[model samples]
Target chain A: MPSPSSTKPKVSALGSFIVIVWLMVLAVAAFLATVVPEIDTLLGRSHLDRTVISAAQAAIAITTVVLLILALSIMKEVYIGRKLR
Target chain B: MLQAITVVLYGAIVSAVSFFAVYFLVPVMIKRLVASGHVVQDYHKPDKPKVPRPAGPALMAGIAASEIILYILTLDSSVLAILFTTAIAFVVGLVDDRKVMPGWFKPGALLLAAIPIIVLGAHPDHLNLIFGRVFIPLLYIPLVFIVIPIAGNTINSIDVLNGVASGFLIIATIPLLVSIAIFGNQDTFLAALPLLFTTLAFYKYHKFPSRIFPGDSGTVLLGALFGALAVAGSSEIIGVIVLLPAVMNSFLFLASVKKIIEHRQVKARPVTLLGDFRLAASKDKSAPITLVRLILADGPLGEREIGIQIFKLAVFAAIMALASIGIQYYFLKDVIR
Candidate 1:
């Protein structure tokens, strides 16, 4: 393993590479925003659109519900009879 | 379907590219600048052994680049609300990282950072439902002040262990991406996806027994991202939930440290002497042990012991994640169907 001092040059190089990637992304987003249609018809934009939206909402809703249940369940198991940790 | 999916996929690609490009650039520039001025400025040289040279400047530079890309891509008042809140935090952290600002100044900086969210209408509110009333906003501005900074510090706290804070970053963004897909918030999703990808890539260097520490800049970036995403999604409660792991860890760490300091003060009798001794003793400790001392000094434990404590925290967080998923399932399964 490289010592701490030895790591800086490698990190700096990686940082440079990340910056290049970021610029490329900007270029692509710009190009796509201009050249490609905002909504795609072939995939039946309306249907997939709703599906995507539902997926997003469901994911959040599910995540929220799941976390609460898990936390409560764990709390009940770990700290129920005993005082809270 | 293929075309739309392709477009979304392409958007993800573009986002990833842009975020990395900018994040990498700022650090190099900062490093060069620092190198030029190295003779004048005395870098932090410790009396004790140090681990990796502090990557604080590099992390700050990366944050600056990320913020700049966020601003450029999303525009001045874009939906990437977390970007600016985090930027404010980063600025505060940067000041501290450079000069070790007085302690009270940190909270003051956080309070200052919360202004953008309040001004931008990202304040938290709860509904008061009686009879037919709907969406009645209450106690919002105060809540925004309390919550944003708390969340900001939460991200800062879990950063104790390597790669831990980034784990929260990845977790918190899941919903943002989900919300974007469902609500046709493609613009926001496009913006966030890159940040997520960049963090993942950076994690390669940041994983356990780490190579590079993300430092304050990375933590602030994440906190800012959480804040921005909360505003854009218009779900303050969910925002807090997503960040529960980090927030809880930070809170626990603070309480733990506070208790330790108080205990030490009591032991040392003259409470003032405790701080003085700690300030002096910090120089004699191992670098990693210093991290433990600063953050987890409720009791003196070895590295393995600290790792266990961290693991317990992670498991605790993982449970929270699972619960969050369960709760959403209960309320929305029928609707989703």
Candidate 2:
């Protein structure tokens, strides 16, 4: 098996992108939890409104899954087989 | 006063039985499994030693026997549910150890294990976070299903190095046990004591230059039990924070791989070997990202040294978990109460 270069691994552009996106997703989740509830109330919705809660829940879930897919596609070839020269 | 004494006696008895069970049963399993040609090459060692594979049955026997004694002394449905979940995970892993199942086998099968907790109704709909408690309500049921598979796999992913799984497990378990005590859940504390004793005992042979491997059965079973205990104790967030290192390892691997697959099935080795047998980070961009690979990013290190680094990371995460307890206190006046 070909060996990896014995050097420090500088953060890849992809790594930075993943980190940034992950933080953004977390921020979005927080927004949904704190801000989105207030938004619902402003719109004449009660605190127990299932519609508002599930909508935020769906948004968070979809955002997370989409980011995961993007990460996989970015690193797909790199992860599966060693493209050693 | 009499009840206190009996509780102490039960704790001592359960621990002793658990310790002895693994201490004795392991050697027998080693002899039997090695004799049956079930040994695998210890590729990480310089000499490439052959070690008996997957002594999970012995560990499970120790745990099950200890749990049975506890139930006999104090019948707790939560205790039985945890035991059943862990045993199911063990069987899921045992199948993989004995035969090559498809990659989906372990994860798919472990979902069944979570059913016991749901069926026992041991988990509440409320989750305690660092800031405050949140009521997941109906979502907690789905969370159980997600947690079991993730827990089983996350711990299994960290079993890459000798003694890493058991040692990390022992380190990670302390906070949970502490939380249980703080909550004054004495019955649950007694139930959890044997788990600690069994894993601690297994480490005697499971440390560097391991005499035997925990295999899938051991890792998955241990992981499942860890998760179950977290749910049963209502300390899921604490458990996750304490296990952040292992959880990070699992996430890095899964995110890199883009799918559910076993480490055994991977073609690209994450860490490559140097002439001295120390593992160096693979410059191969194609290599799967892993905790060990990231650890070696600066340079190659000895296997035992790498194990120490991982343990240190776990300890650091555990301290963070402890800090979160303070956060919980700050948010909720009666945190444990």
For model 1, the stretches where C-alpha displacement exceeds 4 angstroms are: A1-85, B1-10, B22-76, B122-138, B179-185, B256-319, B322-326, B329-337
Q: B1-337 in candidate 2: lDDT tens per residue?
A: 1278887898899999998999999989999989999899988787889999898999999999998888887878888988899999999999988898887888899999999999998777776655555556677898899889889988899999889999999999888887666543667778788778899999998999899999999999999988888888877777777777787688778877778888878898899878777788788776788878877766777788778888877777667677666655566566455
TM-score, per-candidate, Cα-based: 0.55, 0.84
Q: Any runs in candidate 2 off by more than 4 Å, and if so which?
A: A1-85, B1-6
**lDDT of every predicted structure (CA atoms):** 0.46, 0.78
Cα error of candidate 1 at position B337, Å: 15
Q: Name the 10 consecutive residues with the lowest summed lDDT in model 1 chain B.
A: B127-136
Work out the iRMS of candidate 1: 18.0
**What tens digits encode model 1's per-residue C-alpha lDDT throughout B1-337?**
2357754665655565645654564345445544654212211122222234234444434444554555565463543355567677777766655564554555567877777766765443431111111122433465566656666666665665555666557656666455435432444555556556666656555555454455555565566556655554443444554454455444333433443221112222111112111211123221212223322323233322344444444444344434444444454445331
Worst lDDT window (10 residues) for model 2 chain B? Answer: B128-137
- Top lDDT prediction, candidate number: 2
Q: Alpha-carbon error at B168 in model 1, in Å?
A: 4.2
On TM-score, the leading prediction is 2
